[model samples]
Target: MRFALFSDIHGNLTALRAVAAAIDRAGPLEAVVVAGDLVQGGPRPRETWEYLIEHGWTLLRGNEDEALGADRIIHGEYPPRFRAAAVAQITWTRKMLGGEVLQRLTGLRESFRVATPAGDLLVVHSSPRGTNDRRGGQHNSAREVVDGYAGTGAAVIAFGHFHSNFVRATAFGLLVNVASVGLPLDGQPIANFTLATATSDGWIIEQRQVPYDRGDELAAAARNEMPPWPASEATS
Candidate 1:
């Protein structure tokens, strides 16, 4: 069976649509899992949430989702510059999302697990420990990354939060960072995802980068006068 995994939509409906089209073109997929951060950066927060809900995609709550639901980011501290921008954008997103959408966002799960022939696949926004885990978003050291998998009990852990993509074999299991769909920070303005195909030997995973019109999203950001840092400079 083949499963398509993506995350960090961040309200870029264009990227979301492009990635979905690419997944459909790839043919039959057993399931589609969205690891989260569905809104609060790009232009269309409400639209992005509606589209995902309409499709009934499996969901995971990202930090942004939690912040949006709470109407404030809860981190103890963040770099001053980035924290200010994050607060502005998330506050805007919460107001833009209003009632029903915010409720739905609050209801999203923090993690999920699926049993595959190759192994138990655990999906989370950042790591198995949960969405609020700050260390899950960093690869500061190999030891730290490996330690994040403690008690997961899954051979494959698929996640997206750092906006970077990588697949690595660790002492715990195979860790797959599916990356971001809307705001990739890998110096590449492309939509990213991961396809996991269960084989007789094991689970074969493929990371995919689908090209979309970055200009459109950028223009929308410009027109809306969104924060110009972070996502815009991510590809630089």
Candidate 2:
């Protein structure tokens, strides 16, 4: 099966559109997997979400999704490990979102699974174990990703959150990070998505990045009363 994996859209419609156009050019995909943070920070949170969801999406819940589950986030409730920046970002995001949007966000799952021609595939927003899990990787690190699914058996394990894309051969199995489709930590703002295909050898991974309109996204975020963040999730 050929599946498209995308994450951390963060309401950047231009980026999302560019990515989607790229995917269309790439051809028919078995499924499109989203790694969370569908809305919150960018040009059009609600609009971006509608496109991602209404189009083709195999979705997973991110930490920001959980925030929506709460009536109000108590500063003390956040983990001690979270940096001040992360906390501030969360504070701003909470206000930018409405109760209904939060309700939808809260309903997303931490992980997702699909039957592929190669085998069964698992898609996690952060880490398979938990959304908040941050596992570091590639250029940077984050438990929210690789570490979340320490022990797992699957033909391929794909996740996003770290914002860095990588493919690794681990003792567990074939681990691939589709990276962030919104804000890339590599100093590039282009979005990315991955297409995984089952071959006789095993799983073949392809990473693709799409360029979006950052100015439009930034404008949308500024219009919102929320904090100075990019997209969805606390990081947005």
Candidate 3:
């Protein structure tokens, strides 16, 4: 079976569209899975959310997704971690999404598991432990990362949050980080996703990157009064 996995599309509809087009060109995917951070930072929050909903892809909730339903600002949960600007953006995003959409966002699963002929595939926003684990698959050692998913029975584990795409093969299985579809921090101004295929021996993972016009996204941010887009990385 072949499937597409993408994540961290922080409301950049242009990037999402570009990635979707790339995936379409690849064709005949059995499933499309989004590992979350669906909306929150970029301009077109509602439209991005709508686009994902329209596709009916399997979605997982990231930490940013959790913030949509959190009363952080109301409870004075800003400062050290969340800044004033981030809070403002979240407030604006919530307003743009409204109650119904926010409810749906809140209803997303934290993690998803798919059983394939090869083995079980696990997808999550951060790591198998939880959505807030930002370290994910990148920071940890190969063995450490593989060992973290010890009893999950997943032959392949995929995730996105750090916005850095990579694939690691350990004695246990493959740990793939599909990376960001919107705000990529790997110094490449392109959207990214992973295509995984199951085989009798193991899973074949490919990291696909698609270049898109950033002009529209930047213009949208400016029109929405959003803060300047980061040159390298923003707190996701």
Candidate 1 deviant stretches above 4 angstroms: 134-138, 222-229, 232-236
Candidate 1 C-alpha lDDT tens digits along 1-236: 88999999988888899899999898998899999889878877888888998888898898878888777777533577777777887877777789888998989888878888888888999887767564554455776776677667798888988788888787778888898988887646689989999877999999998987777776776776666445555421
Q: Candidate 2: RMSD over Cα atoms?
A: 4.1
Number of the top-ranking candidate, with TM-score as the measure: 1
lDDT of 2 by residue, 1-236 (tens): 78888887766677778888898898887888888867644545667767876885777777655654553343243455644544566555555566676677788777778766676788887666677655635543434334655566676788877777888766566778887776677646578889888866678899887765566655665676445532233223
Task: Give the per-residue lDDT of model 3 (tens digit) for 43-99.
Answer: 889999999999889988988888888934432434655466767777888888999
Off by over 4 Å in 3: 73-82, 142-147, 227-236
* lDDT of model number 2: 0.68
lDDT for each candidate structure:
0.81, 0.68, 0.81
TM-score to true structure, per model: 0.91, 0.81, 0.89
> How many angstroms is residue 198 displaced in model 3 relative to the true structure, after the best TM-score fit?
0.4
lDDT, model 1, position 204: 93
